[model samples]
Target: MARPRTPLLSPDRIRDAALTLIDAQGLAALSMRRLADTLGVQPSSLYSHYATKDEVLDAVANRVVREVDTSGFARGWRDGLLIWARSYHSVLVAHPNCAPVIASGTQRREQFLEMANSVHGGLVGAGWPARRATEISGAVKYLVIGAASTPFGSGFADDVQVYLDRYPHLSQAHRLRHEANRIDHDSFELGLTSLIRGLEPGPGQTE
Candidate 1:
């Protein structure tokens, strides 16, 4: 039999296996041993590819980031930011398990940082100061990750009665705009656009 161009002992395979495990059950379910078992190899053998589980997870984190469509880069910076934000939200919704792991610094990998840097660099090059660019980039990143990390039922009053009776304002708001209260995908983009609009620099604004 011919060997596949990509060999079995490859970063891709290891990272995929780890990601599958994490995405399926949760990150805690994926130990080195579990990953090795899934790969049909011994745990010690995996050490050659990933010295520790964290290394494997870091690779997986980057793999998830790879799914993001940065093609918005060619469309101009604002479009780029929206595209990146939407891509991020899509990826996280597909793999909710990875959001917290990515956000929590359990494996502080460089791919995400590099992505952030690209946004910040574009903004700065477009006349925003480095400090303001960083803020905008950070805020955009937070908007996606923070929204993704929030559990579905979270932020709402756990006690339904409290949400309805005591919090009349909250109840009315929910009743008035049920769609907005739903945490739907459009909500994220709406918030992202608003953030961009708020931070849009004035005529030739800079530090």
Candidate 2:
């Protein structure tokens, strides 16, 4: 007689497999059949969990977002925003293949909205008006996503130098920096700090 099949598959497991595939082979390589093959299951079994590829992609995006630990940022608004941005950026950079999926998916998940509301509440408590708080949060998110999407390869510096050589003004700016020493994290910190500073109230302001 044939051996009985294992019942280890779940929505979470399927999503995990999908994320792994994305990290290893890029999002374009993710398909129901492909995922099933990776999981050692029948392709049709995935439909019982995720209805379509789009749904799978959405789950993958959510998985990436879920990787961000908000506990460390719960202390204050500014600190929370910075922590979230850095954490999110790190996750996206580590999984660049899934970055595009994250960029396109709508953050409609309850957990996601709860996190947003928590951040928004912090800003509101810190003397920011409701509408302005929302706008500032949106701006920070845009900056984080934009920065995470930047492409940096092993040859990126050489390529950038070559391009700058064609533009005298750019070359001048590039020459000021020590190309042998890179501080990408410092650059991210500066940008994040500047953005937070821009959101601060000037002079006397009322809540």
Candidate 3:
């Protein structure tokens, strides 16, 4: 058979296979043996591409982080922050199983580091003090991480009686689980807006 234009195995294919496995079976399912099986190759093949599971995970994380948009920084710091947070949240929500790895810091991943540099640089370029700029980055990261940690609405039980008896205030809470997506999204929007709005520049600073 003629050699295929695309190689049977490559970093991209490995990363994608890892992602699919994690998405279906959670992060623990990722391993050289399992990944090789998924790719229809020998475990040794994966070793040639990635030295260890962590290396593969880092690559997978970089791939996901690459999808987050950093172009909003050009619009303005506030808009950039909002856009970045929303985009990050959307990506995490789409890949809940992989969110932990992505949020676990860049781990020397160039793409993730580049994204971090843009956010910080945009803030400083917008006249934010260096310390404050760092703080803002940390804050937004925490917010996005928290929001993606667990779906908010899903925390509530689907049974109306769960809240109706003693906690009258939460009478409608039971319905929230069914509307998890909408509620979680709206809640994130509210939190992101509130957080960003509170970041007014200090004296000698620019908004």
How accurate locally, in lDDT, is each candidate?
A: 0.75, 0.73, 0.83
**Model 1 alpha-carbon miss at residue 21, Å:** 1.3
Q: lDDT: which candidate is best?
A: 3
Residue 184: error of model 2 in Å?
A: 4.5
Per-residue lDDT of model 1, residues 1-207, tens digit only: 244475557778889888999889887898888888998777787877777777787788888887887667566667778888888888988887888777876424677777776777777666777887777778898898888887443355544565687667777655533354265566677899898788644318432
Better of 1 and 3 by lDDT: 3
What is the Å distance of residue 17 in model 3 from its true position? 1.1
TM-score-wise, the better of 1 and 3 is 3
Candidate 1's C-alpha runs over 4 A off are 1-8, 106-108, 153-184, 203-207
Off by over 4 Å in 3: 1-7, 153-171, 202-207
Point to the candidate with the largest TM-score.
Answer: 3
What residue runs in model 2 are displaced by over 4 Å at the alpha carbon? Answer: 1-5, 72-74, 154-165, 169-184, 202-207
In terms of lDDT, the poorest run of 10 residues in model 3 is: 198-207
Q: Is candidate 1 or candidate 2 better by TM-score?
A: 2
lDDT of 2 by residue, 122-178 (tens): 677766778987887788778767666653332246445676757777665466455
Question: What's the ranking of the predictions by TM-score, best on top?
Answer: 3, 2, 1
TM-score of 2: 0.79
User: In candidate 2, where is summed lDDT lowest over 10 consecutive residues?
Assistant: 150-159
- List, residue by residue over 27-130, the lDDT tens digit for candidate 3: 88887889889888888878778888888899888888899987897888889999999998999888888877877755489887888898999888888888
